[model samples]
Structure formats: C-alpha cells, structure tokens
Target chain A: MANKHYAMVIDLNTCVGCNACMAACAMENQTPVWKNSWRTYVHDLEIDPGTDHQVRRRFFPRLCNHCDNPPCMSVCPTGATHKLDNGIVLVDDELCMGCRACSMACPYDARFDVSYNDVEQGKEFYGELHHRTRPGVDKCSFCAHRVMKGLKPACVETCVGSARLFGDLNDPDDKVAKLVKTGVAKPLMAHLGTRPNVYYISEIERAR
Target chain B: MEGMFYSTQNVWTWWIAIYLFLGGLGAAAVVVSCLTNMYIKTHKELVLWGNISAFVMLSVGSLFLFVHLLDHLAVIHVLNPFGLLTKPDAWIMWGTQFIVWMMVFSMIYTLPYMLETPFWRDMPLVGTILGWFGWLGKLSLSFHKVVGWLAIINGVGTVLYTGLLLQSFPAVALWHNPGVPLLFIISAFSTAMAFLLLVLHLAIKREEDHDIKVLYERTDVILISIELLIIFVFFHFTTYGLESARHTADILWNDMGWIVGFIGFGLIVPFLIEFRGVTKGWNSATPVVLAAILVLCGGYLLRHYFMYAGSYERPYPAINSIHSQSNYNLLIE
Candidate 1:
C-alpha cells in the first residue's frame, strides 16, 4: 500500500461529450450544483472557428491533476491540502481556514471555495447524509473514499464510452502505466513542472 | 483563440487587498518610527502614537482577513505550532507568525510610554490596569532598546510578508514578478511617511520638530521616486514577459484606478508636492495634508488593482496548438 501510486488516463477518442462523468461526480461528491460547479467536467472545444478550413469540436475532460509537486499544498497556510501515500491529494475540512490561497496557486483551476451558505444549501439539496459537513476549499479527491474501498472514482466508473481509465501507476501491468510508458498518454501543461498524474490521449492520434 | 481560454482569478478580492495594504502600512509605520527614535531623536509622543497606530492597523487588517475566511473558526488551525514548524516555505504561515509577534512586541514596546502618559495613568479602570502592568513597563524600559529592535525586525517581517504572500502564488502571472516585493516595500515606507506626516501636522501639531518633519519629507521623496521607477520596471517586465503577464498588463493599463488614481493622483502629485516643499522654504499645511491623503489612497489602490488583475495562464497552449494543427492535417489527409 505504501508503494501504490494512483493515476488516470483519459482517451479523447472514446469520449462522446455525453457529460455522464459530470453528473456522476455531482451526485457522488455533492458539489454545489446550484452554482454550476463540479469536481470534473467536459469542455466542448471548437478548433479553427470562422476559418476556411472545416471547424471541428472536441470534448476535453478536466479534473484536479493531483500533481506530485502541488503548488496548492505549498501555499496552504493550514497544511490542510496534503498528498496521501498513494499520490492522491486530499483536503482536511477541519484544517482548512478557507483562505482560498490553494485556489490562487493551482494552475489548473481545480479548486473552489465551499462557503457557509453553500453548506447550508447543500444540506437541503443533498440531504443530511451528504459527505460535505463543513465549509472549506473543495476539489476532486480522485474519489479517495471510494478508491480506499477498492472502487474506481465516480467519474471514471460512469464514463459513457469507457474513455476514463484509473489504476495504480506503480503496477507495471496496469493499463494506465502502459499508456503512460508508451508515451501515447501525456499530461497537460507538463512544462509547468506540476508532474500531474492525470494523462490525456489526444483525439488527433485516434484519427490517425 | 488567443484570449479564449484566459481566466481571471476570483478567489481573492478587496478584503485581501485591504488586509495587505493595512498590514504593510502598519509594519512600515513601526519601522520608520523605531528607526527615527533610535538614530535621530527620542520623541515619546511619536513612539507612542506610532506603536498604537501599528497595533490598531494590524488588528483591523487581521479582522478583514478573518472576514475573508469562509470558515472563520477554522482559522485556529493556522495557529498550530506544528504547521508553522513544518511549513517554512508557506508565506501565509510565516505571515501569521510575523503579524502575531509584531502585535505582541508593539504592545510591549508601547507599554512604558503608555504608563508615562498622565492621560493613561489617571484613567479609572484603565489606570488600574496600567498600574498592574507598571512593573512590566519598568522591565520593558530597562531593556527598551532590545524591545524596540525586536519590534522593528518583526515590523520589517510583516511588511515583507505582505508582498511575499502574493509572490508565493506562481499561478497568478501579475503577482509572480520579482519586482512585487520591492515595489510593495517601497510603497509601504512612502505611505508610512505620509501617514506620519498627517499625524504630525493634524494630531500632534508638532511645529517644533521641524528637523524630523524635514527628514520624513526627504525620505518619502526618495522612496516615492524609487517606487515610480519600480512601477515602470513592473509594467515593462509584465508587458514583454509571459503571455499571461502581458494580458495582466493589458488589463491594468486600461484600469483607470491604476493609471489615474494610483499614478497620476497617488504617486506623481505627492512626489511633486513633497519635492517642491523640500526644495523651497516652509509651505502651507493644506498642500502637505492633501498630498499625504493622496499617497495613502494610492497605496490602497495599488493593492486593490494588483489583486483584481491576477490572471492565470491559458490552459495548455502547446497542447491546444498541437491538437488544432494535427486535426487540420488529418482533415487535409
């Protein structure tokens, strides 16, 4: 368990822009749905708009990268945002002072503040059994709770076309490891030096 | 496509800006007053008011910081000694430590002076409380220079912490500049001088301390000059440097508050007024007071605009380029 390293591989070729992951994440994490925020979401990118060339739309899914060198963790005053042994970054609600310094430091726009009002509304919107009990900065935890139970993240579990893949990167036999080893799957903004665990397989390679 | 993916950071707002301004102002005031007392002349009134103002400003700024927190009670976690020990690189943790120590040291430094003042010594309940701390005041007076030096060091720390807090956020292109701390330090001192000038002219009405007043005006002129130059460097660096920084410059350039309020009214006018006063003989209090007010306003505006102009780099530009070019090639193929 100490050697375990979790990672995700997202294939743009297989994703259908169905947004099943967003819904699954909202239902699972009880995010501020009324505010249109999510732990994971898909962006419909239009390439070469208003040009002579044919315009094309691609679905780009995004989430917290859970970087090895998380800037959010370094900037957090309360030591609330921390990395687990398995490489998943998580926030301790009781420790977070809600300063949003993590949100300011994150390059991927991964974090959002959960205010007192959001928590009060959440009790009604998500019922009393909601996992979020206190207000703090919130982000995708790679569904660490479920992952600890030997289950995939909600978004990966409910992906419409099986485009999302999650596995331990430390295991050479895992599909995520192979995809990363082959260089077919690449992390976004690699030059930023965050060393993100989430990798993306480009749609252009799929078309080729 | 250039501006399509750019996002302005919205987490921090005016509250954080106010906290930064007040914290810097307070710390700078303490530094100036302490140095003046040690080197030039020992003015008890100056020391007393300076320490009191610093304590009050820092307290009010901390109040704003508390208001900005989403979970107010969770702020206690920031005081965990373990977190402070472990997170040495965290500017916020260092800032909290600096601020707390500064408040404590400033209060102790002010105690001896407070006990000496008849207004405080004769007060009913407060006088009794002051009497309780009279022994502590004697102890502080015995080691007055040590307490003053400690307060000065922490004051400098608090001032630098204000800028370091923003500089630690590498994601915000506007705040990530090396010039940020320099600019903030210079502005903090200049505004501190202006604050003292206002107090000297209006509150203390110390016309006899002409030498000290001249010293403040001279120091402020130099500080303001350096600050204006650093601002130029800031604009040049941000404009020609990173893409996100260039975008930040564009936003800041168009901001009237940054251009007119901060540059025109805040820095330049005050500089000219002080420059003329320093060069010529004694002038009216009206212009001096007006210039001080402008400088203070300008200091707050600088922080406000810097906070609002924080822009994140566009998401994965290299990836987007590859995606578009590769897609176009595939369509052609």
Candidate 2:
C-alpha cells in the first residue's frame, strides 16, 4: 500500500496503431470477441478541422483507466468490484450479481457483462481456456496474472512501437514516473476526478 | 422496439424502471399506512387493510427486483446481512438493509391486529399462543407504537433508496442528479395516496370518511404540481450543467415517453383532474377514482421515462490533434 502505485503510460507520439497490442491482450486474457471485448483497442480519431482545412485521423488506444477512485467499485452492491492495494481495479466474478450497476457507474464505459454463454462461446471461438467459470462483470485486469509474476502486460510487451510502458508510478526511478513528473503524461477525464492510473503522453488539448 | 432490450448498450431497461416505480410505490404505501395507524386510532379496520396491502406491495416489488438481477444464482451475495455494516457506500446494500428491516418491523407492528382477526381467533394453535401471550398484550401494544415509528422511518428510506440507487450511477447523467430522489419521493407519496383512495373507495365504502378523501385529493394535487416543477428543474439543470447531462436532457426533450407519456399525460392531465377537487369538489367517487387511476398511471410513466431517458456520456472521444496544430506540432511540445 505504501508507494506501490502501478500505472501504464501510452506515448501517442510513437504509437503506430498496428493493433498488435489489442490482439495480444485478447489472447492473453481469453476475452470474448462476440461482445467486442475492447479491453485494449486502437481508436481512430479525426482531429477537428483546422483553419487550413485538414483532417487527420490519429490512433488512440483505449482501455480501462484503473482509477484510484472508481465509481464502479463504489456503486457495487456486493463488493464484487474492488481496487487492489497495488492500484489495479478488478472484478470478483463469483461475487458479482450481474446487476449491471457497475456498468452504468463506469464513466469510461470500461465494464462489460460476462454471461455464462459468452464465456463458454469465448472458449470455443478463441480456443483459450479461462479460470473464471461464472458470469459477471468483465474488463481489463491490467494483466494482473502476469504483472504479479513480474512479467509485463501482454499489450505492453507486444507493442510494436514501444508506445506502451508499465511501471510503478510511486517509484521515482521508474520511467513512467519521470514522464509524469515532467508533464509528458496525463490521465484521461481528469476533470471528473476519477484519478486514472492509465496516462497518455500526448499534448492534445482535445484529449484533455 | 422489439429489438430493444435493457442490456443492449449497458443502459438500464424496463425491468429496472418498473422496479423503481414499484419500490417507491410500496415504500410510500407503508409509510402512509403507518402514519394513519399512528394518528387515526379509531379506523382499526382501515389501518389493518393498509398494513396488509403495504406488506404485499413491498414484498412483491422486492421479489420483482430480485428476479431481474442478471446473476440470479448469486443473489445470496446481496442478501448477506453482514454487507450492510461493511459496505456503507453501496446504496444497494443500504437499500437491502432498509427493505429487510422495514419488512420485519412492519410484520411486528401488524402482528397484534392480525391475531385479533376472526381467522386467527378460530385456530387452536393461534388461540393457545394468543392465550399464552394474553398477559403481555399491553407491553406488545406499547412496543407496536414504538416499532410503528421505526417502520415509518424505514419505509421512507426504502422509497428514497430506490432513487439514490439510480442517482449513485455517476456515469449516467440523468440519474446522477440530486433532484432524482426528490422527484421519485414526491411521485411515490402521490401514488401512495392514490392507492389508498382507490382501496378506500372500492373496498371500505361503508367506513370511508369524506374529509380524509378530500385531504388526500388536495395533497395529491400539490404533489403533482411540485413533481412537475422538480422535473422542469431537473431538465433545466442538466441541459446547462454538462455536455453529458445535455445529451440525456436532449433524449428526454425529444422522446415521446417524456413529452407525451410522462409530462402531458402523467403530470398535466392528472394535475388538472385533481385540481377540480380543490376548485370545485370531488362530488362523487367516480371522479376521485378516475383521478387516482390517472395519478397511478402517471407515476409509473414517470419512472419508466426517467430510466429510458438515461444515457451515458460518450466515452473518451478520440482526439487526434489539438491547439490548432497537427500531430507533428504535438511532438515538439
């Protein structure tokens, strides 16, 4: 709990939008494709038209913010959605009642309903086995399975452009910490005060 | 519309709307019943009817909500009473605790009267139990008086909790407003009155009092007017509050459910009908019943539209460039 805030930083400058990270995340997490399990996906954004009349589509990767004060966790009736001491918010599938309260509470639209059929179909379609047998809320886990084992998240490890970086933000020696200290990275929707752990190193005013 | 479902976009649907409506109605009914029983001691039969109807309504509403849970098998997780003390922030947890206590207290409050009924008097086991506790009847009556206040408090909590449950969803702009609970409680109280009026008119015609009926009609009219005002404030606040809130307001403004169903039919028409009781007089049970029916229908529509009008803010719209510059300019910064 002391100085152990794990975070992810995405450098939009270097991101090529190849989607290798998205595929890697899906495979590693055994997420379903039917419902568009966009735990990590590259979004194409069209910049506002300038005075010179030019429109450029920028590649923006999106996922759960893993907030310090997650609304989803606060609204959960059964304590099914919780945030770990290491700063990773996760869902307890067995405890979840599938009330969809967390889904509505998430400002990031990060949570998705995991039906029994969805999980079963996911196993067949992706040919990936999952340890979670029950239906509940599903979302990005920040690769907690691997992170706890000292391995980088599949998305961070497989990024072709080296855009994604995972490290302890509380550690000053960490590159993500330096980047954040230098104001090269910032969390999304800061105005809403969720205090997201996922930061994007971009200077775009619109994203702010 | 057939293709439409509540879970389609992760937005709530009909089940939740109906649940909110029923929950509020049931809670308000209980509170009203308890209040009547506490103050109007002479109408024992009427109070008894109210208590029975309130219990039935609350239980049925709770069951419907439970049935609507997605992971129905895991409902025990919510039912575990320990979570009430543990999960203080969870409004749903608070709601569950309130509901359970309300039911328990309501039953205890009604027990003495229930046993006094002819059916229970004839049963040998019930008679024997009554005989055994006959000496303690005075103590039970005092306990009932104290428990009646507790039930009323819980009843209000149950009604308000339903609104707070929805309002706790910070992501949904329409539901996140402070006015939601106010609107819901007002509608709940009005609907409760309508229900009482209907039952008194149809079921207890002999013992029905004219002054109480007139008071309820007047109170209902005022409630409807306040409801309309709060709804307007809700829309106005959201329309100007945030972009996300504006989106929900836009939905409510355009949708027929809000315009025709909730506003025109639910509030205005009913307000006009109930207004007649104040300006003129009710004169007959027909107008009172008709007005009551309209209010009830309107109350349901209010909740249904409230839920349907809720829409999430578009999540993290991808911004490609900013500051009147291209991505190349961003790199320099």
- Every model's TM-score: 0.92, 0.87
Model 1: per-residue lDDT, tens digit, A73-183?
Answer: 999998899999899999999889888888888888777778889999999998877777789889999999999999999999999899999998889999999999988
Candidate 2 on A1-208: residue-level lDDT in tens? 4658889999887899899998998788777656666677787767656798898666788888899989888889899888899999998888888887877777666766677787688768766455657877778899998999999999999999999999998899999988777777888767776888888877463255
DockQ score for model 1: 0.42
Q: What TM-score does chain A reach in every model?
A: 0.95, 0.92
Candidate lDDT values, in order: 0.84, 0.76
Q: Write the per-residue lDDT of candidate 2 for residues B1-333, one digit (tens) a residue.
A: 111111113236566777777778877877887787678545555666776777777777777777766578888877788987767899988888888788777766766776678865677886677667664555657787788888888889989998899888776667877898999999999999998889778887864477677777888899999998998898788788776566566666877877887788777887888798778876677877887888888888887777765654433341211011232122223
What is the alpha-carbon lDDT for the whole of candidate 1? 0.84
| Strongest candidate by lDDT | 1
Give candidate 2's error at residue B96 in angstroms.
Answer: 1.1
Model 2's CAPRI class is acceptable
Provide the lDDT at B281 for model 2: 73
